[model samples]
Target: MSTKALDAQPKFAQIKQYIIDNIRAGTWHENQRVPSENELAEQFNVSRMTARRALSELTDTGILTRSQGLGTFVASFKSQSSLLEIKNIADEVRLRNGHYSCTVLSLESMAAVAPIAIALGVEVDSQVYRSVLIHNENDTPLQVEERFVNPTLAGDYLQQDFADFTPHEYLSHVAPLTEARHTVEAIMPSNEVCQWLGLFNEEPCLQVIRRTWSAEGIVSFARLISPGSKYRLGGHLTFKKKQP
Candidate 1:
């Protein structure tokens, strides 16, 4: 927008729109660093704080990402999940034409704690299979999957290569899902979570507490974490028409 036009309305909003317009027009591609606050302020004849607000809002909404000492850049394409169904993470990334990979951090049998036992419908201190993994999209960390499995249902849980096939894929093969439940929350990331996801301290995360059931009983309890700027959950529905 021209200086005169920008002056006609809220300058900060106009600056935000200007950046968004450039991005939409492909003038600024993904991972391409945009102008600094000082540059933007100089261009728009506004204070740095006004320019900073424009950048900050876009960053919070996932349109842009700011790296410490590295200026702002357009955000990478976000990974998305279904709110209506259980879907595999690998498939979700590939559906967006992005490469998918995973790192299996830990896989072992552990005694269930009370909360885990309650979630998994198991007795406290019972042996359960636990796996911790980081799912990546295009080599960038996307989701942290920490799961506790009912050993009776998936007997060979620890033997498989999770880097080759996800826990969701393997569990589905062993004990097909009869039902699933999910609870989502936005939370501040722990230091460990931040390190795993390569997230800054200010970035919030989306946490999903999930439980899956098979014909016999509860199969697993899982905690899924994703950086708010890197992942989203959504669903679409169509309503039937009523008789007029």
Candidate 2:
């Protein structure tokens, strides 16, 4: 490694930018282990804490990853997708000429809250299925879907292979649909959600609140939020023609 003069920024910030620049320049490849904090400090003529801050910030930003008893390594870069449809995120990615994948963050059975129950037309405190899914386009985080399903209609949803099949596909096969509603807005992502989406501080997100109903009642409710730079929602409606 060359010992270039560090920039005038804070030692940590300077070190952070150095690492990022090297990574961008391809000096550090994906999954490649970076130098230890002590080594970096020696190379940069800084304290170990300063070097550690650089690595820590990168890790927090998902540019690098650290493992206990192991070492820090470069994180893989990701790409985003733009698809406007009420469909499976994985399918959307695939259709957009990108690779599609998902990570199931959590799957559990929980009691529905009053608002959720009312939306699903189920009794308050009824058992409901909840799932948190992180969908990626071309290995880049695109959206985080927090979904709730009426277990009375779609039972054992937690057992399905979401990576291979979408909730929309499974629901369409099982549930009888009647109506659908959607509301879109903008919001800042939470820390956890931001990590899930691999978003930077400047990136805003488009938040979509959706509800689907069946003959029996409301069947599902979901909150889907995507990085604004990566997604946009669009639709078209036509009015009925009156007989002359």
Candidate 3:
């Protein structure tokens, strides 16, 4: 860590970045315990509170995990998605050398409720397609996908065999998303969702509420949920410096 660089940011943020950089550089690895607050406070010449804040923030962001008696360790992100792009979950898992599979729990057309209608930009009680699926990585359920589709966008949604292709892949072929919006939050999933994802009691889930549009109209609205400890969202962006 550079002294000038350390001076350039808040003490806690600098320390946090130092830890992140180390993790990125492979100095610290998954399941490896990180330095304690006392050790980091001494190294950074900051209070234990500052060091603790750095660790807490990282842990909250899913970069680290903490145990009661054990120290903080790098979190093993078994499944990851890019915050910058829309991708197929099956492909995402396979890219990481994990086996991908899915079970279609429900696939049917139904009358849209108020929230589903609004999300799909359809009239209340209008016909829409809904599909519920559990996506797995290495036979462990990693995500629970609940999606409502605009019939105008993907009329054949309920007819396809999801075993042959994911809903994302099917929709992309028919509609080809021109725009998308996503909202992410940490949530305590519903009992059914927890059961599908095989999460323990009180375990937090990362939820992404997503809406996508084609050149025609809103294509689909989806809620994708995963156990926070097993999945993570990340992105990398590079900005070019402006000319003087």
Candidate 4:
């Protein structure tokens, strides 16, 4: 957005950006302590609630982790990415002994773009449902999910509360997957992704795009992004000696 747009932005949002800028600037490295709610309120001359909202939003997006006794600290990404063939991110967090939470940014219908159309086997410009979600582990932002659904396959998608359940969990319960294709790459996050993930523009993100099919046909297409500084793809395998 333009400078005027940012200037006109809300104070909490400005605080959010300020926190991200410091993180990116190495002023607040991983595991470092961030200003307390009272301190931030004083520094920004805003109410404690305003400061808390800024910090809460950042924590929800996985930039900071809060403890019951300890003050908030820059979250460290020490856990591995999903190892299951069909990775449910919530499950991943649980397996790592972390509390899981989600914030649903959007769930709406729009005309499909070309790539999304092909992924859903719908014609370009066909109506499709899309949702943007942020998943956090222990109040730290973990992943940003951008999902496009075939409306015919998931007609009630918009009616569901994703914050109570994940798009992956809901779809898997509604339409069991028959096939899936995944693509993974590391790249600089987009402007919006950077904002949502609480990362600087130069921060790298692990991008995982996937398309799924149910017995009835295409079910959904999704893009999942993880902060590269804190996430990695991981799996385990067993080896056998042949007639040793």
Which candidate tops TM-score?
A: 3
The worst-scoring run of ten residues by lDDT in candidate 2 lies at 77-86
The residue pairs that clash in candidate 2, if any, are none
Provide the lDDT at 34 for model 4. Answer: 93
Give per-residue CA lDDT, model 3, range 1-244, as digits (tens). 6878778999999888888888878999989999999999999999999999999988755677889898999878656688899978887766444579999999999999999999999999999999999999889999999999999889888889997789999999999999999999999888999889887776889999999999999999999999988887887698999999
Instruction: Please list all clashing residue pairs in model 1, or write none if there are none.
Output: none
Q: lDDT by residue for model 4 over 89-117, one digit each (tens)? A: 88777644468999889989999999889
Instruction: Tell me how far the alpha carbon of residue 194 in candidate 2 is from the true structure, in angstroms, after superposition.
Output: 0.6
Clashes of 1: 0
TM-score of 2: 0.62
Candidate 3: give its CA RMSD in angstroms. 11.4
Candidates' lDDT values, in order? 0.90, 0.79, 0.89, 0.85
TM-score per candidate, chains pooled: 0.70, 0.62, 0.70, 0.66
Q: Which residue segments of model 1 deviate by more than 4 Å?
A: 1-76
| lDDT value, residue 87 of candidate 1 | 89
In Å, residue 230's CA in model 2 sits off its true spot by 0.5
Report the candidate with higher TM-score, 1 versus 2: 1
